[model samples]
Target chain A: MEFRDAWAIASKDLRIELRSRILTNQIAPYTLLILVLFGFALDADTQTLRDTGPGLFWVAVLLIALLAIQRAVKIEDDDAAKERMLLTPVHSSSVFLGKAIALFIQLFVLEILLFFVMLALFDLSVEDPLLICVSAVLATIGVASSGTLYGVIAAGVGVRETLLPILLLPVLAPIAIGATRTFGDAFGRVDADGWAWFGLLSVFAVVYTVLGMLAYGQLMEDA
Target chain B: MNDVIDLQEAVVTLGQFPALTGVTLKVSQGEIVTVCGPNGAGKSTLLRLCAGLLPLREGSAHILGEDLQKNRRIIRQDVGLLGHRSGLYDDLTVEENVAFWGQMVRAESNEINEAIKLLGLDGRLRKVLVRQLSAGQRRRTSLAGLVVQRPLLWLLDEPHAALDSDGRDLVDGLIHEAAASGATIVLASHAPKDISSPSGRFVTLAGGRVTNDINNDGSGDGVS
Candidate 1:
């Protein structure tokens, strides 16, 4: 697969997202609202909230990742755009990579915002900055790869709206656990086994990316 | 000359319904073929099959000498399809939509501009978003993208659907031009009379089967 073809697809998606401002105007605000709602629901002391902020941050990430995938898939919903991409000479794996990359970048930006929001809202402090950054990057890759794979899988199904969450949530459980635990280790709220959790997140990201590249062609046939 | 499309008793089933029930047809290089039928008569299915969009359920199907069942991915590069949908992103301007597909095919910038000129969208209209354009304008943008690809085979399903008289004339001209340049054309339409090319062949499909096949020379055969 030509890297240029993949870049073309990724650039096109990113440009569309930038022009529409859908992620910033709608999804990002919704994610922040989730963080605010969690704060209200916790209604705990600063120490308790700080201890729990890492877990809540990941919860918000998982939910917002769903919206990101949905928007990515919806861009192809009109005018048989997905078929147009599939019909190109470029390998189907490249198309999958391009979409996964785009979603990763969007989620990356969202995570940065959420990280700052968590810092302010819960009075949290990063004890291990490097571990937090690495964990967030690895975890975002994991979510984007798996989310894109399942997004296309469900895109053509009749029950796609219901099917996407059903297919994605179970698969995302591992990433959620690994990310939250890694964050805990970074913030010194738990024993420093940050490397082990980061390793798990990396494994999830690599496995899902390879799986998506291998399965994309077959999925296009049915999608 | 090599056969651009060769399907022998091709069967395509959509769920419980058979969209194409054993359709056998052949078209050589540089031939303009028109497929006309009612809504459920599978006119669109035949074009899609040629474009490698639909799976062949039974019988042999080959496009550009590549087996449809096995080499679908390879066959797709040699074919361009213009279906019911315009395939243009509403958020993208006319130029961006055309350039995106042009880049996909790696067409040169000049070639892309030439295609846009053919569709008469090279001026102020090119900067307008697709959602803001009229249906005919969107269709023109879709055609421009297809033109940039310059595939060996063109599968046009209702290419004249949302066009005005001038745009319809443009579609006819494009078909002839593409065919003259050795590109095989298979156009599906409910109203075949609008396509008035003298050198074209007409194949009438009914209930997913070809009922009549007529050549430009007026010689014809009935398919059972």
Candidate 2:
């Protein structure tokens, strides 16, 4: 019930992550690697590549975020941090918030890395800065809530490294599709139904956020 | 004797296997009861159910006169739980490790400081990571966390697995301290211990049911 309870968990995680920079640094190059690979697969077709580039770029970004998120999920168990956190009287909802925030920041950073990489790779232009940023933020939230929940689940029973992605991507596909279409609207210079996908991704983020908060205590209970 | 931890037909089941069947148990405010059994003897299950970590499939449990499901958080606030695993983060220093949990439970800084001293961790508080410490030291941090907050009930599983003679004594002392405060202690271990002078009730189980329920008569609690 403490106002700063969630921040307590969040600050601890952020502090530890800052102390060991390996966790975030690994994502930056991984984003670049995926972009380079995407370029090779697309080849030199300006017309086809540009039309699909926006969609593929976001897909690459989402995948990179997912990768980083999976690692973030395991942070608790890496050093028995999860159990230590559970022992506290802080509500489980706060724990979920702390973890979701950590992953959200990591995902946002990954998306930023993708934005720069896309500009360099294909001379990408930001058609609407506001819309692109909005879509990216929503997409990251959608990924962070769902990814952190599954990460907690996996951390309890299985090897989180393999289980996090498998559990998150399928559940988060709607976010990706929504992000793809929204980003495409910005790049294609049209505003057709972009708000629809925006609405959909927003709903996903809220639903998962609530689900993660309410269920984490139960998760800790059995595990 | 005023009952501190009393179970009334506490039946907890997991899928097809009945974990705790028609089990009746009682421990006074200053009593120490050790539940010993085989691997699948439901020792851990009973402790977990009491800790509100496991659900009661049938019957009910009352901790300090509070229902588990309806008042789980209140009970959790007053209970200290330590499972078979040390559950210590290997990367953080000992001070951070204890502080993190203490901060969550809102333990006073002075209480945490006293726990650190009692556990003999003041010298290596900031320098040693859990991974760098011996098993005994790692367990000691966990003990410190358990003692930092003054809980009315203590539910522990395999607490002395990695502890040395001195470490065991440390735990034994903490158990006595908690009981002197009218806290109920339920410990699950595989071996016998010589820490307390109270009436140590022995509950032995097999196939997830009480096989004998006897007092410290050395004949095993006649729980069968």
Global fold similarity of model 1 (TM-score): 0.98
State TM-scores per candidate.
Answer: 0.98, 0.87
How much is the lDDT of residue A153 in candidate 1?
94
**For each candidate, what's the DockQ?**
0.74, 0.45
Model 2: per-residue Cα lDDT over B18-121, one tens digit each = 88887777777777777788898889888877776666777777877788768766676777878766656666778887887788778888888888889888
Cα lDDT tens digits, model 1, B10-43, are: 9998888999999999999999899998889999
TM-score of chain A of each: 0.97, 0.90
**What local distance difference test score does each model get?**
0.90, 0.75
Q: Candidate 2 on A1-223: residue-level lDDT in tens?
A: 4548877766766666665665567767777888787787878556556667677777776677666666665566665556545545788898888878877876687677777777678666777777888887888888888877877777776676676677777887898788888877877644566767888888998999999899988786655
For model 1 chain B, where is the 10-residue window of minimal lDDT?
B215-224
Model 2 RMSD in Å is 3.2
